[model samples]
Target: MARISYTTVSPLTHSLNVTKRWTTSLGIWGVGAGAAALLFLSVTPLVRREVLVKVPVLKLYYEDTTPASDKPF
Candidate 1:
């Protein structure tokens, strides 16, 4: 004949283990979310300024009777 023994954890220990697991998971998620927010904020200014820059222009001078051949092509 064989006898088996089972040990049970206390209620306080079980509650502590559950709380530890929840806090650890929450901390990991919070760090990831914070990093994503910082990256977004850092990149936003560069993207927003792209549309506000002006293009360069050149000025030309010519006579009313200037022929097409005399103009800069």
Candidate 2:
């Protein structure tokens, strides 16, 4: 009697085939867009408190430095 064997496609290979070079480029572009959005939102109050304030390096940079006399809003 002879043994029988079967070959199967791997998950990694399947995924690689489903995604093309353009998909990888699009992912890189998406990351860049997200970073740009975060940078633009950095000065907003919500972002400052929730994101910048927690960062050790940016914490000092985002601190309120103005005096009461200069603050009107």
Using TM-score, give the best candidate's number: 2
Worst 10 residues of 2 by lDDT: 13-22
Q: Which pairs clash in model 2?
A: none
What tens digits encode model 2's per-residue C-alpha lDDT throughout 5-73?
988999998888878756998999999998899899988989988888898988899877889899897
- In candidate 1, stretches whose alpha carbon ends up further than 4 angstroms from where it belongs are 43-73
Cα lDDT, model 1, residue 43: 45
Name the lDDT of candidate 1. 0.61
Q: Name the TM-score of candidate 1.
A: 0.41
lDDT of 1 by residue, 5-69 (tens): 98999999999999998998999999999777755764464532442122122112111355899
- What's the distance in Å from true for residue 29, model 2? 2.9
Native-structure RMSD, model 1: 16.9
